[model samples]
Target: MKRVIRILISYALALVLVIVSMNCSFVNIKADEQVYLSVSKSNSWESEGKYYAQFNLTITNNSSKNLQDWTINISKSGGEISQSWCCFVSDLGNSYELKPESYNKEIKAGENISNVGLIMSFPAETSNINASISPVFETEVKESPNIKEEDSNKEETKSQESVEVTEEINAGDEVETEEIDENLANAALVASRCFLSYADAPVIAIRACYDYMIVLNTEPKEEQETIAEAAVTAAQTASEFATDGDVESINTANNANDDNNAYEVSKDNEPVIEDSNPEAVEDNEPVTSVAGNKNIPTGRLRVSGTKLVDASGNVVQLRGVSSHGLSWFPEYVNESAMASLKADFGINVFRIAMYPREYAGYLTGGDKETLKAKIDEGVRAAANQGLYVIIDWHVLNYNPNEIKDEAISFFNEMSMKYAGYDNVIYEICNEPVGADWASQIKPYAESVIATIRANDPNALVIVGTNTWSQDVDAVVGNEIDDANVCYSLHFYAATHKDNIQNKLRYAINNGVPVFVSECSICDASGNGGIDYASANSWLELLNSLDVSYIAWSLCNKAETSALINSSCSKTSGWSEEDYSDAGKWFMQAIKNQ
Candidate 1:
């Protein structure tokens, strides 16, 4: 009888503790504004007696965390959406759920999207919706991976600095360390709430903790890390608990908490959604791109005073790789492969080499239409990945006059197809060797130029110079009279030393704009040894000039120029082990930043 009574008492206490612990998460919810949603009637004229109008929805995400499967549910006088643009809207009786489109799907931190417009019909001027409306959003429920090792190293450095400051405070120095430490701690506390995964916690919390702990000058190193780790853990746990709440509610027959339940990230990184029932995303919801630091925004490019200027009138230099003949190596033109180049290798542009005269090239090949379609697909992929694209007409030994008509047709099709896209660049001729810039190549370029300009007048066009694009000096006096025009400069580091760079300098000093369309740190044969000394010299020169350039051949060929191994087959997400010597060098150069 005594043993039974003791077991019952212990069981009762355990249940009470569990209830209190769970309740603490729910009651201690921190709320701030990291995301905001607003809706307004942009253009609306009633279509029928039932009433109809156009509404513009805007979302602003200010946090660094990447969110997916986001939803925006609104009830405005029980309205039904008929058509939507820039987003997929599913009508749910009186409310609606909105998902992002490809272009605006993954809203990067500090980005605002105001293009989501909808045509909906409802009673004219609903009271609460039209008068005053507020919206709420949910962060990603899935746990992100651990922080990168590099990021941890950075945190460890900051933590050490804080310890030094605390030592000063202990020696009768001002409480400066404490103030600095508290500020950082506050920031980290907020970061913890924003990025729930361990990967992101240090991205926010570590540095902050270092600052705060320095003020607590007396605290040991281990103690500082412990305190920071605890704060991050609390925030992460809160997010997981909230997601559970959302999921639990979804499985129920009636979601009674749907209307009143919403979560937000506060200025101090606090959790808003703490309920165990999550709003589950459907299996078919369009997934957003992973948040990456490689995405670059190259606004409209143009030729301005012997340099390439972006839309904001700032001179821009594009660094990237060109493919080694599209038909021969189409495997590397995939989204995943190109993404690795951008994210890991730091390439801003990808040059598509369209050989018009190979054994099975575009013109005489059986895959005529298929080749064109593949080129089109590559351009679309570039745009989707936020990368600039170059459509190179790889003309080596063939005379431009022989295929003038075909070239005209091809440029017309491509220019019209990729019109208005800031990422598209036209490389009219890859190499003009058999003719002079003024007489032979110049005339051929005029015709093709006229064709492309007819379709895309504002696109950046790169014309090949004579002597296989080494004779840029010839284009000094006889420059194209079109807007956004630049001359191509190709070089082989081991073969064409400062001799070629002399001509490059002469052209730039004069009134000629140049773009290094193709280059490699090897001999011209594409299968020679790499010359690092010469390559470093060239790098120094380009950086001084702020010149835009693309490396030679992003293929798996057994050569010095190829970035990857010949046997390795990967489209994207490549590890460092997958790269060759040349590829490794490029990665280091970019990361040297």
Candidate 2:
């Protein structure tokens, strides 16, 4: 009788605690009130008696709870939408309802989702097209006596089970660490939420958690790896979700998070110009050493009607690889390595990437003279190997105009230094993120081009487009006046799909000179799995169009984008086995071309 009374008392207490927990869960009922929505419209383009307008929608969640499966009501005065991204639209009589796609369905608390836009086509006669957006928050249900008895019973059982598990864990019963540490699988997701919540969360913090997840993935025990794989997938998905299509944030996070620290420096295979005969490479030769040799190729490169042409108006496609930053990978620029590539692969061009914003970069406390010397060496090496070289001003973190004066000074000096060399090309900007084509990038490019033209008038100059050089279509009608300039288009095959390919096609068809300044077989983050199919398709398109393309990059860093294997530290003369997976694919692609 005493045992039964005690059991009943315990059951009563558990039921009371369960009721309290259920009541607490209702705190999120007013979450919809904390969310805000705004819409802005811009005229994207005018074509064929139709005006295309983009309605960019932004949703900001201020609540502590995440918002998912959300709906927004958009009322438009005129025009019909041709296409939309990041959301699905449904017509409901006079208005439209928008729902997020599965990938971006959840908007974490305190985070805002931008770049959710739709293009609407309006007849040229229609001058005023307007749209308004409002979130369709879930209806609030009041607490009533008519509650479902079964639901209450289920909640009670769940709460009771949770309590039992906690008690068991506290009692020190043998429990699988995986079961107890299930939250580890969700660490990335939680961290992503936290990142969205805090305005000052360091990027390295997120990278540390992601790196730990990678370590979990490589665990020797299968049981331990189950959660690790989940964490990795969650990290990738969370990374995608957190950025909400912002290219700058994605690139910054990616650049900071790549597995660069995992690289091994091989003492035996140091980056040196080794040769059977030491006299093959002469020291400190200028570009004029082979200036008059017709066999080594002569004449300045010019842009002629969507094609890079020689002085004789013959179309030429420059296929080559770009170095990883010169400050970090200077040893890869030796003459023997370039000569070996020219002999084996028939590569015609080489790009020297000089980062200006990263650690040890030119603009950030690095030895400017030392970097300039490295660039000079690389240019000389490429010129000696009968290869055209590109001096890349790799701008990533800031808009081109943000550092316009510095760019002008840098380009002025470089162009004057290599003015007489036909083999030297200038990439004014590597990847201009978060800059407008008509205002920011174009103006800055014009300034730099003007400076370069003062010295090398006919030199082939490449300019980056908006959205980290992925939005080539943005440069179609609003092109720079200089005929020698080519707009840059960069892509990572695994992340970019037909939409990006369509941008390239549109740019080419519209006579916007397109040059793929940087591309790879991995994701945009530069450290994910390879997409051979997409890469092959992209190469086929480039080949058909005779568009110049460059692979990124030349280094032994343990990332998917690195052309060389991390284990093999040789800077040049890479055999089949010395290539990473993406490296091998890129090498074969270049060879096939």
Candidate 3:
């Protein structure tokens, strides 16, 4: 076994050297030869006189013991990084120091870590890259103690059985891991990391990998996961956890490979009652609020031939602010804040952004009840203030289809809870990144829509488009065949100029119902300098088309897109001085409407 291990290590080293020599990249291992860092150009392209490339780095733990607290250094010559994932990089003038995130800080013996890389651009003439691992400790390789052949065979048999158990789990078969060796935990962690390399793989495989990482507590650097047994347990049960749903229709939609029609809803399944309090309002009766004024009038809203219309058939253009992630800013989700926005800011819509994968997100270990309570409070507050509320399933780092079952369960419950409320609009997906409209996203949306329609048949539904909801034109001809559905179009005035505006125009011109669910006057990152000129242009276009629009956020965080000044701690009843620059501008825009 030791001889085989040495041979494999030698082969890996030779392969790294070949890649280095061919690509002009570099590799450096610790002096003790326990760890190795190899850098190679995984991809490259040329645009005009500039060269663009992605460098993939692999770290191998060659020692017979676990390696930790290490760093990789890269001496980059004449290239500017455009994007990077899986490692925290520090700029060191001509070089960069990369440190592993918490979940990947330790690599077990003979394990290698991949999916740590970056993309950069440089002048066509310069493309040199040098990489080396730091603090090379000198340690001699130790031989394993010999064991009797009889005992060795028994241990090997146990290890092989454990391996078979994990395979069974991956195949969606339930199995017992009581006799599994604990050491397999580390192997699972390494396995999850390798899974990241399959970017174009099937959604189930990626989701299972994601759940595996989460279960192992090995959130990669990109999002950040942890635990070997828990990781194994996650491996054993992640698919089951992902596919948890009560209704057969939901289970069908959750199955990515199921040929069942995406638009089918099981009417036989009763609406899930989220709350059963004796004092709770009757399920069939709509909650009516007498909180209507000229500035903030509300009623059932419907999509009518490229326009959002009120019950009276008059074209209605909604204008308002969206909350930052509810988990992050629960303090702002109060009735007083809703009243303030309605009375002072002249806004009629409030979007509650519930992230599904961010810190304390709904699907990622967030206190589900707590987040749901906040959503409930926001919905009721908006209704009581005569404001239409958008329940946004904010998907920043994940695709909508990756967690379709969870989404189905959530929207099912929410739609049921707010079934009778006319002011509540279900924004099924806030922003879907790297999702196809015709294939992945459309089907996911149809399934979710079918679920929503089960309870609230006529409630307005907003669906996100591809590429962070900016590709609204993609839905021009391939729109969802459901009534009262609008495609989301998000923008930041500083980043999305006429190109995005043209896309919106194209969608609208092609008779696609469009809703600007989230937007800001700053850059797309929700930061950077405010571009009021571009914001005004956007408002002008939206107003002319009578398109409803909502600002990116209403939080007081010290950022470009925050509506309130960071210094103001007060959650409601803000004076003119309490508004951020973007906030003040948005306030005036709502008043103008």
Candidate 4:
């Protein structure tokens, strides 16, 4: 019985030892399998421009014991993990897996296990990276292997070298840095210089280039301050070569950062200089006592170096053409065609009709592109001909206030472009009538005239009286305050509104410059007019009064007093041969005066 008891005890002891050893083996086991993992990246990166950054990770294991069911985790401070892999282990465990966050490999004692790969993206903007790796083992028992000190040291050195290279690249110290490219830098410099030269203002040029460089460098905070400072210095240097009215130079100089303190120096000295010149202040005095009437056009109309005089002085015949609807008919005013006709005819001025339908297209929810093209083509053609082109804001049925804003924009663009050119004038509103005259037309006309004069002080502006330009009494009553202003009135014998001679007398007597921008022997319905017979009579009266007259139509048609028939053909009414009849008589009248 004693012998049997002893044997049972020994068996029990053996079982306990086996269980304890199994648990101890797993705790002491070190992965013996050799594993290798690496990462790679691409050269191109962002949409705005190109960039390059890649994170590479390599993992290797060398041990005698099998590594089964282990976990490995990797963490990087400034990179995005794009891909990962897992490994499987079998033996001494039912089923185990290794994940990227916890990368684990399973292999036999002498075999090697490695992750497929891991890809990470590091942006160029990132400056640092802190990596952490952890490995958990769950396999057979084995002693931990001693890694070579030299090999560990080599890995640390390589990592430090990689960090240094990344730093250099971020700092733009790399040979491939775009900002530092000699060709690119030179191009930028040349462009900036050209801009400064043209602006004639060093401050403006400097400011523009500074902005450009900021864009070129993508406005990085680190580069902004440095580039801005450099731009200021460059602009100041350029300003030394610019003249007083050299806007480009002034702009460039003003834009320079270094000159910011000196930007308003000239302005500050203006008061002192102005005080010294007493006559200057008097000359600059406002033209009208009305608070906002300072911008009115006030200049004497001169012809042949002599100021135009009325019956009180020498006779001055103004031979003008009523260029009806010329802007609406840009095709007629061709440079090669109309220019020659105008010069040959001795036509000094032309009337422009503003059609509401054409202008409303842009102002009232219509196609802007089409309207702009039409306007640009018409204005440029007339200007190129060197003929005094009138910008007629025609409102046949007045709604002046309704179209005021659009009208102002149109006039401003016109005046600004033609400000210094002597061959342009403005006609505020055409043919306003009835109650619309006082309530809408007058106010609207006043606004437009003010806008144009603000941009072009010397522009000759024509204002029409109410009642379709037939109310001479209303015109003389309202009376424009501007000296350079003139009144426009239309006459058609068929209407019998007033005698042409009587109207002329009233205008001359009142000392108001009268311009017959539109008139026709043929009635509004386009009938009745014995060709030159009636037209010649009207022309005689106009010539006598020295009033400028533009014929009703340059091209003959059913709706007009056709000066030239369709196809530019001389019809029975007025042939091309006869086209010169009215023009010749008008020229003779002017020469006689």
**Candidate 1 worst ten-residue window by lDDT:** 247-256
- In the range 103-134, model 3's lDDT, one tens digit per residue, is 35557678766546666778874544666665
Ordered list by TM-score, greatest first: 3, 2, 1, 4
Instruction: Count clashing residue pairs per candidate.
Output: 25, 0, 8, 36
- For model 4 the local lDDT of residue 163 reads 10
For model 2, residues 1-593, the per-residue Cα lDDT tens digits are 12222333433343321000111011222343466555555335565566765555666667665553366655554566665655667887775667664334456668766646666766764433334333322111111112222322233231142111112122254645433232233345333322121111234343334333322332212222243334345445444544443211111121111212111112233243322222232223211222222223646788889998887888899988888876566667666566655654667888999887554467754557767877887776676666789999998734778778888999999999888777889998887756888888998988899999999887889999876687889887888888888989998886566768889999999999899999998866566678898898999999999999998888765577888886664656567788788877877777776
For model 3 the local lDDT of residue 176 reads: 39
Report the C-alpha lDDT of model 4 over 1-593, residue by residue, as the tens digit: 12222322332232211001111012222233333333222111332232223333334434453333234333343444433323212122322222331112333344433323333345555422333223322221111111122222222211122111111123333445433332223323323332111111223333344333422332222243344445444445445433432322423222222311111111111111111211121212311111111111222233221123332345444455544443223233323233344444555455555554221223422234533444444344444444455667765534456567877888888788667655566777666544244555567767887888899876777776654565544455555556666667776543322354466567567666777666666543233433455555766777666666555555433233545542242211222354533344444543454
Regions of model 3 farther than 4 Å from truth? 1-298
Candidate 2 residue pairs in clash (backbone atoms < 3 Å): none
TM-scores of the candidates in the order shown: 0.51, 0.55, 0.59, 0.42
Q: Kindly report which residue stretches of model 2 are placed more than 4 angstroms away from their true locations once superposed.
A: 1-298
lDDT of each: 0.58, 0.62, 0.64, 0.42
What is candidate 1's lDDT per residue for 1-593, written digit by digit as tens? 12222322332232211001111011111134355555655334343355655565666666453322245555645676665655555666756666554234445556656556665667775422331112222221111122122322232221122111111113354545444333434444333322111111222343343223222221222243333454454344334344433211001111111111211122221122211111221112211222222223766689887788887888778888888766556556655556667677777788998877543457733255656765765675566567788999988633577678888999999998777677889998887645677887788888999998898888899988865577888898888778678999888776566668888899999978889998888765454578898888888887788777888877765566888875454544567887888888878775565
TM accuracy, model 2: 0.55
TM-score of 1: 0.51
- lDDT for position 201 in model 4: 20
